[model samples]
Target: MGPTLATRLADWIDELGLTDHLAAAGLPSFTRDASGAPSWIEADGEPLSDERLAELDASLRDHGDDPAHGVPVALVLLARKARLRAELLATPAWTYDHLAEVRGASLNATRFWVHKQAEEHHLLTVAQGEHLLVPAFQLTPSGDVRPELLPVLEPLLAAGTDPWDAWIWLTQPAGLLGGDVPERLAADPEEAALVAHAATRLAQRVTASPKPRPRPAPSPVPPASGGCGCGGHH
Candidate 1:
């Protein structure tokens, strides 16, 4: 079994070079108990004792459907997502006008067609604070839609995978690709069929899962109407 969170927390405290702080705070050196769990955060030798960890894990699982179940953990998760979103948006992207130019479509008509493609799951769209973005990974350097992307995106999009989640899946290493990242693998003609199969299997798993859908967070402000200024046509 993997290290328990209690154990991992102790390791993180050390890994982050916080052991000195813990020492300064008059706490004993961080160490694992007999079962490899951390010697509890307080109470001398048992803060997150096995019983407490079990209780906490059970509580989390029991209220997994509740957004407010674990406020601190949820906040940490949101912070991590925000970081990922920022990094993803920092990459090259395309605007409707740009895509239209690449496809020889009417510049003025791009907004309509691009939105339509998004609806059909033929395109991926990310809505940031005040903008919509099409991360450029989906396009060739010459700005045409990458052929390998289409077939793989078909099943994933059809399965209702969230755009952000789809991007994460595509960018992460896949066992089916022998540790090759999916988006990177897309550039290889020899691996096209393999990537497509992996995406299909991913979609199948997504469709088959019985997990409860997360409650959508309400956006405090309306999304900006115009798309990204990516093409420099703004």
Candidate 2:
């Protein structure tokens, strides 16, 4: 039998050197009960019961003004780390609801946490539309390509044909186009060579195209005007 998802994630976390962060946050390295549900060890070496963990999980969903009401900031950070690790191992395309269902968390909270981590790592793009959490390589009004597609597109584009055309042509069956260029090329070696040559030319054109400049970073927000606000103020 294959390893469980949580175990795979734990291995990835260790590989990424995130276990120390979890330790600093006073959470266990990673533990699995007989039922395979993951739980964290407390600072005192006692295992946190599922019921208690569920309570802490619920607390994170509450947006109360009282900072004391939610889970510890550190725990939240560790949870984000775990979620990121899980995402990295997941298939290229997964929606926010999909991840929430996997992690057993509220959709809103899961979306916020996943987006925040994704932004920090720049691992993937997140888009929200019609109340769905969409993960893609490029964020667009319609939808983004799966993260895995970017690498495929990049190499295909660099080789000289329009990436989209290459994508469709390469993926389509040999005879599906009937007597069209692709179909004819598939039927003859000489024609296939010519088609490959044409693809190279297109890739050259795509590679020669100038890339757009990146946008500037946003300015930092100013502090509130109420005299430093906290009790540390004079």
Candidate 3:
């Protein structure tokens, strides 16, 4: 089954290690109802303060039936609950224009939809400028996925391996997540072999050439005080 809103929110918090912050904030942990909709409440079983509850209500109401919108809102809630200002600033979810470009869709409709999604998910704060930035987060560039792996993995996705499997295979070996390479390889034998083979080929290609020699040193000039003029001084 596809990831649920609660699961996605939990994953972001757990991955970023924000549990302590959430506890400190006194926000209730996220939970889902039988219908698969996510909800939260205060730890003391009392409703949140008027202002805070209103903010949360606004976020909940704004989301207007788009699955993609869940990703950003869950992320935002986790950030707010955990007080993870730094991480929030780091991954400002893609803006409306960014979504349009990536999805190759109409600008006006895409922006409206994206805005609705963000509102529903509570993923962003007030929109400003031409783009909306994540309230407290700043996004950094994720390096390109290894070029060789994309070809291999795209086919697997097309053929239909679970997305988590695809995500793990594409990202792990490149040390995107860092840590013991061999351990990761052992965990997934087939993918590990593919990555190793690709890496070996890439290495061989790069090292096959000899390093270029340094350019020849320039000739030195005589000092002005030297007696090398046409007067024939010895």
Candidate 4:
């Protein structure tokens, strides 16, 4: 065998530059057991049991691998977790039930409103387990949706921009807005107009540009002759 699972996984983690990220997330660090097999130790020094390790290994295998890129498909899945979710997982957010209670509205009514608003791109909602989470940044202190934020959100939504990407862009500082975070900028009536204009321009630019496609998977070997399509005729 080439590299054992422990060794390969360690190298891949380093290659992906996720060591700090994993640690920040409280994930167990990978290591070799006494028998030189794969093991993990939690932050509290609790060892991951053998049975749990086997289950994790099985899950990783089931996630499959992309032979084309030599990447464990699971790793891609981990890294591609909607950018908003990755960055804002710990951000203050409210679930439908919580919003319903706060608004004194029925859960069904709240759900309907949230779904409609989110679908219209008037709200930022992130999928979390069995529920959708609305980050507090888009809401008033009274738990009501910030109507001012809606205009800024509309351009991105109307442009068919992915909600996750829009969420990240809105929350990040934008040079166009003099490094003001769009979400915060939208909180001010005077500044919000600027943010809306910036958002509209951004949406227009994204719409006018062609998205980059993934690089084609490399071929295993040289083609034989005669302009083979696959680049591998062996």
Candidate order (TM-score): 4, 1, 2, 3
Q: What digit string (tens of lDDT, one per residue) describes model 3 on residues 111-179?
A: 665456444432223333455543222112321122334334334433434332333333334443244
Question: What C-alpha lDDT does candidate 2 achieve relative to the native structure?
Answer: 0.48
TM for candidate 3 is 0.21
Q: Write down the worst ten-residue block by lDDT for model 1.
A: 67-76
The local distance difference test score of model 1 is 0.67
Where does candidate 3 clash, by residue pair? 63-120, 73-121, 88-137, 89-136, 89-137, 89-138, 90-138, 90-139
Q: Rate the local accuracy (lDDT) of all candidates.
A: 0.67, 0.48, 0.44, 0.71
Query: Model 2: runs farther than 4 Å from truth?
Result: 1-165, 171-184, 212-216, 224-234
Error of 3 at 85 (Å): 7.8
What residue pairs clash in candidate 1, if any at all? Answer: 40-47
Candidate 1 vs 3: which has more lDDT = 1
In the range 151-192, model 2's lDDT, one tens digit per residue, is 333444445443234534444333333435442343365455
Instruction: Report how far residue 133 has shifted in candidate 4, in Å.
Output: 1.5
lDDT of 1 by residue, 90-162 (tens): 7776777667776678866777766777777777877765666677888776655677788888889999887
lDDT of residue 41 for candidate 2: 64
Q: Roughly what TM-score does model 2 have, to 2 decimal places? A: 0.23
Report the lDDT of model 4 for residue 98. Answer: 82
Alpha-carbon RMSD of each model: 15.0, 22.3, 29.9, 13.5
Candidate achieving higher lDDT, 2 or 4:
4
Q: Which stretches of candidate 4 lie over 4 Å from their true place?
A: 1-84, 209-234
